[model samples]
Target: MFSIFKTFFWLGWISFGGPAAHIGYFRHTFVDKLGWLDDQEYAQLVALSQFLPGPGSSQVGFAIGYQRQGLLGAILAFIGFTLPSVLIMLCLALLSHKFNQSPLFEGVVHGLKLLAVVVVADATWGMYKSFCKQKLTSGLCLLTAAALLLIPSISTQIILLLFAALIGCKYLASNQSNTHQRFTPSIWPLITFGLLIFALPLMTSGLPLIKLFSDFFQAGSLVFGGGHVVLPLLQNIVGEQISQDAFLTGYAAAQAVPGPMFTFATYIGYQLIPQAPIAGALVATLGVFLPGFLLLLGVLKHWQHLAHVPKVSGALNGVNAAVVGLLLSALYQPVFTSAVLNPSDLVFVLVGFYLLKQLQLPIISIVISFILLGVASNWIV
Candidate 1:
């Protein structure tokens, strides 16, 4: 438990750039360094998280914890990995004005975004080789990338996954059948998930605390694509209750902080119930994240079993390819186009990529280097 907490605690503090970047970081730490699981297992988890409606990266972390030490470990993982960002976001909500004019802070945030570009690039290449080894799979990856690039939206992304799954089921499945026992998952987690979906709505009109929980839980249950996707849902859900400024402030703070972007809930919670801020923060954060955990628990065991089946495995392969393409589109538009505005920024990314890929600098060292670069770039420009 201590080890699990320690690992994810550090991860939460430094996981920036959003879910795709978190996937890269987790792959490096757990799959490469620790050898806890191979590339295949990790890819399946990524695909599963994307299919589920919640914070994709947090679900990945929760699944990792569950794989390591069962339910308790999953809880510890979510708490440790989410706590740092939750605190940062809450503090940001409290001190929104203080951060408005810090070039240094902006530099660091931009630098982290650049780091995400490098990390995602590396992850995409690695996954391509692993999951897209076949001609059909490679075509699916490139085609999905092209489709999403042409029409980029959450709906398009989901449709692409479904289309890819259809291709996988029809064309990619092999006749090879290995005897593997099916793992029956507990029905209780699914029941609880359904109950919360039903019960939380009823509770939304009661106490402030209950209303807060319901609102966040609904947000967690409904939002797709995670990260920035939560912003609008949050804005719409809490817009009438909190000032628009407070809601926007929390969204901004969420980007600056590390870990899952859903920690923005902490800021909204703190703002809504300032008298009992800690309780507010805890309930809101937990409420928003709980559904993802429940869904992960309910699906993971069964998914693992299904992943080995020839037909199902084909569909997962397609899903995995689509995941890589999604990362690719994200890397280009948001991470690249948004951050790399000038030649100097491009040079920095190239250098950073070389160091990470060829020279293999430690992620911490790379992060620090980019931070300094970001700070220096601000002065130089």
Candidate 2:
């Protein structure tokens, strides 16, 4: 447990770029370096995390912890992975104004956006290779990608609901006999946590209610897709109440830093209510992440039985494919929309993608180069 915490702590401090980059770091550190889980198991965990809700990277972290040391480890891993971003975001919130003006800060953020593009592309490719090899699955992937591109404003929850219904229908239609058992849906934890989160606002007062409920609920809710997907839900909840500039600025800054992007909540929370920075940060961070943690705990507690269910596994497979498509969509709307504003930005993005996909250069190096380029460009132009 201690080692898990320490490992997560280090990752939280230095794991930057975005969800894709964080996955790469996890593959290198946990899979290659630590030998925590074999490749197949890791892939399964990745697939499972994508199928569930919440921040994909942080869920992956929780999955890793669960695989090694059970539920306790999962909790510890989440804490480790989450703490650095919360602390740093709080500090950044305190220095929000100056941080925004710093040329170096702008450069780092610029470079980081490019890095984010590469990371998302790479992750899409990786998932494609892993799960979309079958013709039917590959076709589904393309279809889903097209759907997302055409309807960018649709909430991911709706898409997921449609997919789940389709999977259920298909399962009911199939007559083929199989050894896999049916998974009984466990509603207790989901129900209990849901009630707790909703009741939280009533349990407290002032900023405390907002902070506690937001963080705890966000953390407990199972919101799959990735970090960018969390934005709409979060913004809908907190946008009207807080300074839009500060909220967005902190979010942009999250891209420039390491660890999970969900940590942006910490920055936004602190900035929204500075007098209670710690409490606010905690609330925001937890609110954004709580769902994933609760879902994982529920799943892990029943995975042995759930894994035997053919329909459940099949549905998860479809969801995983959709997740890949979702990531691809994100690369366009938020990421590409922001990063490639000019010819120069296009050049940097192309170079970064080439380095990552072709030359297999380290993502950190690409991020650094782009930051320097941004700084130099700002000086010259």
| lDDT, each prediction | 0.84, 0.69
lDDT of 1 by residue, 1-381 (tens): 799999999888778888878998898889877888998899889988888889999999999999999999988988899989987876777777688458888888888778788887888888888888888888888888888789988899889999888889888875768449686776888899888888867866658888888888888988788878888777877768787877776787787778998998888888788788878888888888888888888878677677778888788878888888887887787767767878888888899999998898888899899889988888676
lDDT of 1 at 234: 78
- Model 2 TM-score relative to the real fold: 0.77
Question: How do all models score by TM-score?
Answer: 0.95, 0.77
Worst 10 residues of 1 by lDDT: 174-183
Whose TM-score is greatest here? 1
Model 2 stretches astray by more than 4 angstroms:
1-7, 13-53, 154-195, 205-211, 214-248, 251-256, 271-275, 342-367
Compute the lDDT for candidate 1. Answer: 0.84
User: How would you encode candidate 2's per-residue C-alpha lDDT over 71-130 as one tens digit per residue?
Assistant: 788889999988887777778888777776787767666666666666666666766777
